[model samples]
Target: MSMGRARSVVLIGMEGHLIEVEADIGQSLPAFVLLGLPDAALRESQDRIRSAAKNTGIELPRRRLTINLFPASLPKSGSSLDLSILVAAWAAEAHVAGTAKVVFLAELGLDGRLRPVKGVLPAVRAAAQAGAETVVVAAENAQEAALVRGVEVLAAEHALQVASYFRAPGAVEVPADPAQEIQRVTPGSPHAEPSAGGEAAKDLADVRGQAEARFALELAAAGGHHMLLMGAPGAGKTMLAERLPSILPPLNEEESMAVTAISSISSGAASVTRLQRRRPFEAPHHSATAPSLLGGGSRIPGPGAVTRAHCGVLFLDEAPEFPRSVLDSLRQPLETGRITLHRSAGQVTYPARFQLVMASNPCLCGLNVGSGTQCSCTVAQRRNYLYRLSGPLLDRIDLQVQVERPHSAALALQQPGESSAEVARRVAQARAVQTERLAAFGLSLNAEVPMNLLSEQLRLPSKEVRALDAALDRAQLSLRGYVRVLRLAWTISDLFLKDHPEADEIDAAMVLRQSAGVRT
Candidate 1:
C-alpha cells in the first residue's frame, strides 16, 4: 500500500482554483471512499475512474482505497478531476515516472477514452499562473489549452496514451483525428483564423429614412452609450437598432478573448474554434424574467444576456412591455459594468459592460404618436403605459431620440443612406480618438469616463459651463442627467474632431435628453 498525488483545477464562475488530488491504498475490505465537498457529478466519478482504469489494463488493488481533495472546503464540482484521481490512484501501486509536475484536466470515459470538458482555457490559465510545469488535457481541448503560453500541453485520446507519455517521454503521440483536432494557437497569435461566414452582413442603408434616429445610432456606437428609440410601429426603430452593431468598431484582441470565453462557458465548451472580432449583440424578448437577463441557477449562476453582450449591445424592443422588475435588474450592471448574483450556494460576478438600446411605441395602440385620431386610448392611459419606465431607469440612458415615420416621398425615392462600411469608418476614427485621450485613465470611451474626471479635467469652455449651470438651475436636468449629457457632449466632440465639447455639442446632447417622450 502506498500514497500518490496529482493536481487539477476547480472552476468557480470564470475563476479557477488549483487543487491537489491525493489517493491512499490500504489492505482492508475492498472499499473506495471520497472526501471533500464534491457535487453529485463529482461523486459519480469514482465509478467512471474505476471502469476506465480496468479497461485501460491498469488494476486497482483489492483493498481499501481513499481519495481526498486537499483544501477540502473549496467545494469541488464536475467530472474534470476524473483523470487526476485515476492517475493518482494508479501511481499509488505502480512506478509511474514523470507524474509530479503535470496538472490533469479531462473526463474519463468508461472505455478509457478521454473526453473534453468545459472551462479548460481558464483551468489551464490558473495552472499556469500557479507555476505548473505542464498540463494534460483531451485531444479535443488541446488547441484551447495551448492558448496559454509558458506551459507545455500534452494532449491524449485515452488513459493508456497519457500513462505511456508519462512513463517514457516522447513515446506517445497525439492521435490524428481531423474532426477533433483543432489547430493549436496562442492568444493573439497571428495564425488565429477568423470565423467563417461571420455575423450576417447588416447594412445601415436598409433603412428608408429617419435621419435623427440614424444620427443617434452613430453617436451610441461612437461613445458606447445607452440609447432609446420611440416611434410608432413600422417606423424603423428595430432596423436602426439591428444595424447599430454593423457600424461599431471591431473588438480588440483582449476584448475578443473575454467575449469568447464567456460564450464558451455559456455554451458548455472549453473554447470555440470560430473566434470572431465582431462584437456580440443580444436581444432578449420582452417576456424574459429577471433571472434570465441577470443570470441565476440553483448551483452555479450562469451568465445571462447582459453578461453575454459584454463589450457589445443589448437591445430591448417594446421595452415598456417588459416587467418592471426585469427592467430594474439592469440598473446595477449599467452603473458598475458587471452583474453580481448571490445564490444560496455562493456569489458570482460576471462582466456586463454592454451598450443598451431600447425601443418602444409612443402608446399602447402603437399609433398615438403619429396622429391622435388613429389612437383609441385616452391621455391618462397613454401616460400610464409609458410611465412603466421609471425615472431612475430612463436617467441611465444617455440618448433618447424620437423616430418618426418616413415621408411618402422619401419612401418612394428609395434612396439608400450611407452604407454600414462608410459609417463604420467614421465611428472607428472617433473611437480611436477617444481611446487615445482616455488611455491614461484606463477608459476606452466617453460613456465610461467618470463625472469627476469630466468636471476636473475634461470640462468644456466657460460659456458652455454657464449654459449648463443655467439649465441645472432651471431644474431642466438632474445631477445624473447632467453628467450623462456631458458624456454625450464629449461623444459629439469626438465625432466632429473637436479638441473639446463646446456650446453646440452641449446643445445637441440636450436635444437628445429632452426627446425622452415621457417627462421626468
Candidate 2:
C-alpha cells in the first residue's frame, strides 16, 4: 500500500480555491473510487485517466485506488483536475517524488495529450497565493500561467512528458505528430486587430450631426456617467454609441488587471497573454435574456455583459425592444458597480462598474419626433413603448439627450465636427481634475461621488442650485434624480474648467437630464 498527493485549483467565477488530490493505492480488487463532491463532468475524468494511461504505455497494477479531494464538501467541476488526479495516482503506485508542491492544471486527452483549460491565469494565481512553488500546464497555457509573479511554471504537451518530469517508471517521450503542429486559434480571440489608424478610424468625426448628442457623449465619457439617447432611426444614435469608447480613457494598471482576469476567466486564458489596456465595450442585442445579461449557469454562474464591460461602456441599442426584465437586471449593477449572482452550488460576485449608454427611438414608429408626418403609432402606443423603460431605470441614467436629424446644410458641408482625439484630450483632462479632487474620498470620477459628499462638503450656493431645488419641490425629479443632476452639473463645470458649477452649468445639466423635447 502507498499514498501520494498533488494540488490543483477550481475556480468559482473569478475566485479560485486550491484543491488537494490525495490518492491511496491498496492491494485489493481492481477499482477506482473518486471521493469528492465532483460534478458530472469531473466524475468522467476517471475513464479519461484510464484511457490516457493505456495509450501512453504506462502500466497500472490492478488494485483498489481511491482518490479523495480534500475538503470533500466543496463541489468541483470541469476536466481541469484530470492531470492532477492521474499524477497523484501515478506517484502512489510508482513512488515518484516531488508532486506535493507542484500544482497541475490541465485536461487530459484520450490519447494521453495535455489540453489547455480555461481560467489558467486565475488558477495559477491562486496556486501561487496558496504557496505552491511550481505549476505544470499545457504548452498553450504556459505563457498565461507565467504571468503570475513569483511562481515557477512548467510546460508540457502529453501525459508522458509530465510523467517523465517526475521520473515515473515506464514513462517515455511520445513522438510529436506532424499533423498536430498547425496553429490553433484560441477561443474568444479578438476577431480583428485594431486599425492602424487607431482611434482616429473610429473617431467621432465620422458622426456628422447631432452636436447636442456629441456634447452629451463627451460628458458621459468624461464623468463615467450613464446616458440615454432618444431620436429617430437615422439620427446617428448608434454611430454615436459605437464611438463612445474612442473618447474614453485607457484603463489604469489596477483596472487593467481586473479586466484581464475577468476576460481570461469568462472567455479562455489562451487569448489574453497580456493585460487589456483599452476599456471594454459591450453591446448586447435587444433579444438578450435576463440570465444572459446578468450572468447565470446551471451550476456555477459566469460573467455577463455588465461584468465583461467593467471600467468601460455597456451600450444597449434599441433599448426598448429588450425584455423589461433584462433591462431591469442592470439596475443593481448600475448603482453598486458590482453584481453578485447566487446559484445552488455557490455565489460569486463580479465587478460591473461600466458606463451605460442606451439608444431608443422616440416611439414605436420611431418617427414621432420632428415632423411626425410619417408617424403611425397612436398616443397610447407611443406612451407604452416609452414606458417599457421603467421609471427607476430612467432615473439612474444621468444624461438623456435628444438626437435631432442633421440639417441638409450641415450635411452638405461634410465638415467633421470635433475629432475623437481632441474630445478625448478634454475628457482626460477633466478626469484628471476629478481624480485629484476626489482622491481624498477614494473616488476618481464625478459620477461615483456620493450624495452626502455633494450635499455637504461640496455643497453649492443656494442661488446656483435654486433651479434644482424648484424641480425637486415640484416632484419633477426624484431624490435620486436630484443627486444625479448635481453630479452631472459638477461634470459640466469640470469640462468647462470652472472651480465650481455656476447657475448656467446647473441649468445646462437640467436641460441635458430632461433631454429637452423628449418625453421620459
Candidate 3:
C-alpha cells in the first residue's frame, strides 16, 4: 500500500481548523471510501475529484482508494476539501514528498477547473496561524488568500496547475500581492458601495423638514446608539432611516476587514474586490422568522440580519409589526454586543454590535400624534398596538424621537436641509472626541461604555448629577434607562465640544430618552 497526505481548512462558523487529508491505495477491490465526519457535500466529493483528475489527464490507481481526514472527530462540511483530496490522491500515485508543507482550499469542477469557495480570507488566516508556509487557492480567491501576511499564495486555474506545482515545487510562481491587486481594481480610498437591494443610496438632504428627527439621527450615528422613530404613515421615517449610512463615518481598516469577512461568508464569495469602509445596513421584512433574523440553520448556524449588520446599522421598519418573540431575541446581543448561537453540533459567537434604528407608527390607525386625527381605534387598541414592543427592548433603545410630517410651507421651500456631508463632518468630529477620551477604556463610542464604567469612572457636574437624580427619584427612568440616558448625555456633550455634560445636555438626553410612544 502507498499513502500520501495533504492539508486543508474546515470552517466551523468564522473559525477554521487545519485538517489533514490522507489518501491510501491498497490491494483490495477497486472502490473508493471516504472516512471522516463529513457533511453531505463533502461525502460526494470523490466523484468530483475523480472526474477532475481524469479530465486533467492524471490517472488514479485503480486499486481500492481510501481517503481519511485526520482529526476524524471534527465535523467537516463544504466542498473546500476537494482540492486537497485530489492533491493527496495524486501525490500517493506520483510518490511526491512536499505536499504537506502547503494548505489547499478550493472546490473542484468536473472539467478540472478550480472553483472559488467561501470564507477564503479566514481560512487562509487560520492556515497562517497554524504555521503553514504556503496556501493554494483558486485564481479568483488568490487576492483574498493573499490578504494574510507572512504566507505565500499560489493561484491555480485548473487542477493541472496545482499538479504542475506539486510535480516541481521549486518552479511554482507566487501570486501577486493582494494589496496591489485590490488597488488595481479599486483605485481609491475605501467607500460604501450601493446596497445589494438595488436601492439608490439615500441622502439626508432629501427630507424637507423634521429637524428633531434629523438631530436624533445624527446623535444615533455619533454615539452608535439605538433609536426608535415614531410617526404616522407618511412622516418620512423610512427616508431618515435609509440615509443613516451616508452620515456615519467610514469604518477603520480593522473594522472594514471584519465587516468584509462577514459579508463574504454570507454571500458565498471568497473575495471582496471593493473593500468598503462604510458601515453595513440590513433591513429585514416583518415576516422574517426568528431564525432568519437571529441566524439559525438545521446544521450550521448561518449569519442573520443582525450579524450582517455588524459594525453598521440594522433598521427595522414597522417595528411593532414583527412578532414579539422575534423582537425579544435581540435583548441578549444588544446588551453584550455579540450573539452566541448554540446548536447540537456546537456553539459559535458572531459579532452583533450594530446601531439599531426602528420605525413604527404611533397607533394601528397611524394617526395618534399626527397633524389631523382620522383614527377610529380606541385607547385599548392604541396601548396594545404600541405595547407589542416590550419594555426591555425599548429600554435598550437610547433615543425615541417623534417624526412628524412636513408642513405645507416647509415642503414648498426651495432650500434643502443640511446635506449628508455637512452632518457627517459633525458626526465624525463627535466620534473622534469619544475615541480619544475612551481610548484608555478601550471603547470607541459612548454607547459601548459599560454602565458601571460610566457611573464610576465618568464624573458629571453636581448640577447635572442632581438633575439626573431628580429624574430617577420621579420613577421616570429604569435603572437600565438611566445608564442609557447618561451615555446619550455624553454623546450630546461631545457634539458640542464640551469637556463634560452640563445640565442642558442632561436635559436634552432625557428628552431624547422619553420622547414619543410607549416608554419603558
Candidate 4:
C-alpha cells in the first residue's frame, strides 16, 4: 500500500476552508472509493480524473484506490478540487513528493486540459491566510487569483504541465506554445491584462426637469440612503433611477475587493479579470422570488441580488407590482446590512449593504397624479396598490420623492441639465465628509450610523431637532423613522457644507421623508 497527500480549498459562499486530499492504493479489487460528504458534481470527478490521467499519458495502477477529503463533516461541492485529487492519485502511484503545502484549484477535462473555476479570488485568499505559499489555477483565473497578496500563482493550461511542475515520473510534455506554457503570476504583475473598462456612466444631463427629484437622487447618493419615486408612467422615474450609479463615488480598494469577490462567486470566473472599482447595480424583475432576492438554492446557497449589489445599488422598478412577501423580505437586510441564508446543508452570511431605489406609479391605472384627472380606479384600489409596499418597508426608505411629469417647455429647452461629472464631484465631497466624521465609530456613511451613536456622539441641539421630537410624539414618525430623519439631516448638512445640521436642514429632511405619503 502507498499513500500520498495534496491540498485544495472548499468555498462556502465567500468563506473557504483548506481541505487535505489523501490517496491510498492497496492490493485489492480494481475499484475507487471517494469519501467526505461530496455533492453530485464532486462525486463525478472520479470519472473525470481517470479520463484526464489516461489522456495525459499517465497510467494509474489498476488496484483499489481510495481518496478521502479531511474534515469529513464539512460538505464539499464543485469540481474545483479535481486537480488536487488527480495529483494525489498520481503521487500515490508514482511515489512523487512535495505537494503537501501547495493548493490546487481547477476543473479537469476529459482531454486533460485545465478549466477555470469560480471564487478563485476568495479561495486563493483563504489559502494564503491558511499559510499556503503556492496555488495552481487555470490560465484564465491567473489574474484573479494573483489579486491576493503573499501568494505565488502557477497558471497552467493542461494537467501535464502541473504534473511536470510536481516532477511526476513519466509525465508527458506538449508542444512549447507560449500561451499553453506554465506562467507565474504575482500581485500587481504587468503580465496580467487589465479589465476592459465597463460601459460609461449614464449622464444626468439628459434629464429635463423634476429638479426636486434630482435633488433627492443627490441626497440618496451622498448619504447611502434608500429612496422611492412615485409618479405616473413616463415621468422619467426609470431614467432617473438608472442614473443613480453615475453620480455615486467609485469604490475604494477594500470595497472593490469585497465587491469583486462576491461578483466572482455569483457570476463565474469569466465575469471578473481584475478588482472592479465601480459599484454594482442590480435590477431584478417583478417576477423575482424571495429566495432569488435573499440568496437560496436547492443544494448550495448562492448570493442573491442583494449580495450582488453590495456597496452598490438595488433598483426595483414597478415596486408595487412585486409580491408583498418579496418586498418585505428586504426589511431585515436593510436595517442590518447583512443576510444569513439557512438550508439543510448549513447557513452562510453575506454582506447586504446597498442603496435601495424603488420606482412606482401612483395607482393601478397610472393616472392618480396631478389632481387625479381622468382617473378610473377606486379609492380602495389606489390605497391597496400603495399598500403592496408595507409601512415598515416605506419607513426604512429615507427619501420618498414624488416625480411629476415635466412640462413640454422644459423638455423642449435646448440646453442640457447638469452633467454626471459635476454631480459626482459634489457627491464625492459629501462622502468624504461622512467618512471623516464616522471613521471613529467604524462606520462610513450617514445611513450606516447607529441610533445610539447619533444620540450621543453626533447629536443635534434640542431646538434643531424639536420638530422631529414633536413628530415622534404625535405618532407621525416611529422611533426608527426619527433616527433615519436624523441621518438624512446630517447628509443634507454635509451636502451644503455645514459643520452641523441646523433647523433648515432638519425641516428639509423631514419634507423629503414625508413627501410621498403612504395614505395618498
Which candidate comes out best when scored by lDDT?
4
Assess candidate 3 and give its TM-score to the true structure: 0.91
Tens-place lDDT per residue, model 1, 226-256, is 9999888999899899899899988877787
Q: What are the clashing pairs of model 4?
A: none
Instruction: Give candidate 3's error at residue 152 in angstroms.
Output: 1.8
Off by over 4 Å in 3: 95-97, 168-200, 370-372
Pairs of residues at least 3 apart in sequence or in different chains that clash in candidate 2: none
Q: In model 1, which regions exceed 4 Å deviation?
A: 168-197, 274-276, 440-442, 465-474
Per residue, candidate 4 scores C-alpha lDDT tens digits across 214-295 of 9999999999999999888999999999999999998878888899899889886656788887889999999999999989
Per-residue lDDT of 221-301 in model 3, one digit per residue for the tens?
999899999988999999999999989998877887778778768886654644557789999999988888878896779
**lDDT (Cα, 0-100) at 331 in candidate 1:** 96
Please list the residue runs of candidate 2 whose C-alpha ends up more than 4 Å from where it truly belongs after superposition.
Answer: 168-201, 371-373, 470-479, 516-520
The true-versus-predicted C-alpha distance at residue 458 of model 2, in Å, is 0.9
lDDT string for model 2 (1-520, tens) is 3888899999988888999999998899999899989888998999999899788777556889899997799899999999999889888876356788789999999989999999888898888898988888887886677667678778788877777667645644434443444222222234212212223337898888677889999999999888999999898899999999999987777887788788888886466666677788899999998878888887888899999999989999999999998898899999899999998777899899999999999998899876788899998998899999998898778888889888998898899888988999999999989998999999999988888999898899999999899999999877887898899999999998899998899998988988734443
Q: What is the lDDT of candidate 1?
A: 0.84
Model 3 deviation from the true structure expressed as Cα RMSD, one decimal place:
4.6
User: What's the distance in Å from true for residue 231, model 1?
Assistant: 1.5
Clash count (model 4, backbone only): 0
Please, what's the RMSD in Å of model 1? Answer: 3.4
User: How well does candidate 1 match the true structure in TM-score terms?
Assistant: 0.90
